[model samples]
Target: MSTENYPVVFGTEDILRSLCDSVSRVLSVTTQSQIRYSGMVQRISKTCLKPDIGCFVLFDGGFSGLVVINFSAPAAMELYEQYMLNMGMSKDELTTSHTSDEVSNVMGELMNQSVGDFTAKVARELQTHITQNQPKMMALSKQVILSVDTHLEKPEARRVTFFTGRNNIFYLELAIDRTEFIKLNDFDASEVPDPDALMDQVHGATAARPAPAVSGTSEHDELLNSLGM
Candidate 1:
């Protein structure tokens, strides 16, 4: 399989389109979607994007990660707003606690749909199975999620990112641990189709609308690398 992305077993556009469609279809509300730094997260070498409202990470459970996903600050806020709006609350009166809790709940469901779609595609392709549990909300700073002092185990840490739809930028530290990292190190392009063919489809699959500019490549890569894989 190709290293920049998972090898293209079936249709690349088919998978990504399914993912984007699934993300939009699953969310209960449409709360302004956007992206930041839509490119490679060099740190862990994970495919990442900085959404306007936040950032998030997706991982394979085979990596033995305790926490497989994470999101960013504004992402929390935007989701909190969506929850508030869905509940019929006025945006002006929203407070800190309400926003934090609401973001956690909304993002948790978002993680569910996203992971479900990802795993479903893999399962169908490999003819394997994966089951997902409820994802918990961090509701605190990005550091809080990683700090064992906060009681979130570190061993299971997977790739982290701040996926959002607002604008400024979001970040997540996606750690894959050494074990899974090794599996990826040996990966190549055998499973993927012609790079030109897949890249063509992958690029075409993105949003037609213009988006805000994101951060530098080196910076994004540093974040992904920290994730260990």
Candidate 2:
């Protein structure tokens, strides 16, 4: 089974395409950015082109190893604005912005979808039922991060990267162990981690989770507090 492992599973290019497709289907977007993801597996050796948001791990339930997911600050901003803040974000707003769990929340369901789709695709080839575990979200600064790298105890792993955008730069990525696909659908929603508790943790750690995106930056930013993330 190990020999069948495909490094392309970690291919950011493919995952980015998958994510773009997944998000676009559920949410509308012009997809103007030229996103590019590094080809190498997400590792400390690879330099982050942007800020770090958080890391997520996947489990197959029985024997598969856990795998990690990561994104750069720019990518996170794109996700926050495109998915949550409405697909029209000015470059300045995205660059200067600080990340929060709210940002994570905007992209969480989409992230789950992307990974789940990737898992299903990989599993179909192997004739196995793959599922997603409840995603673990966290907030962190780029300063303390010694390494942008990630690894799993499983014997098998796959990594890849790509650049996407009008200029042909990769913005986002996903890494997976094909053998590690878990049966995430196996459990009911209640069995999953409480999003409320998780969000509380994020607010407690980050610089006050940004209130939900307001109608306009000014009018909305003020109203964000009342939205109750």
The best candidate in terms of TM-score: 2
Off by over 4 Å in 2: 1-51, 61-63, 85-96, 146-154, 157-159, 162-229
TM-score of each: 0.45, 0.47
Give the per-residue lDDT digits (tens) of candidate 2, residues 138-160: 55666654233435443333344
List clash counts for every candidate, in order: 44, 33
**After aligning candidate 1 to the native by TM-score, how far in Å is the CA of 58 from where it should be?**
10
lDDT of 1 at 149: 19
Q: What are the candidates' C-alpha RMSDs?
A: 23.6, 20.1
Which lDDT tens digits does candidate 1 get at residues 1-229? 5555644343323333334444544543445454333334333433223322233443444432222333445445666676667668887867655235555666666767766775665554444454556665554433333332122233322232334555533443333344311123333322534689888887877655578687566776887889965
lDDT of 1: 0.47
Report the Cα lDDT for candidate 2: 0.47
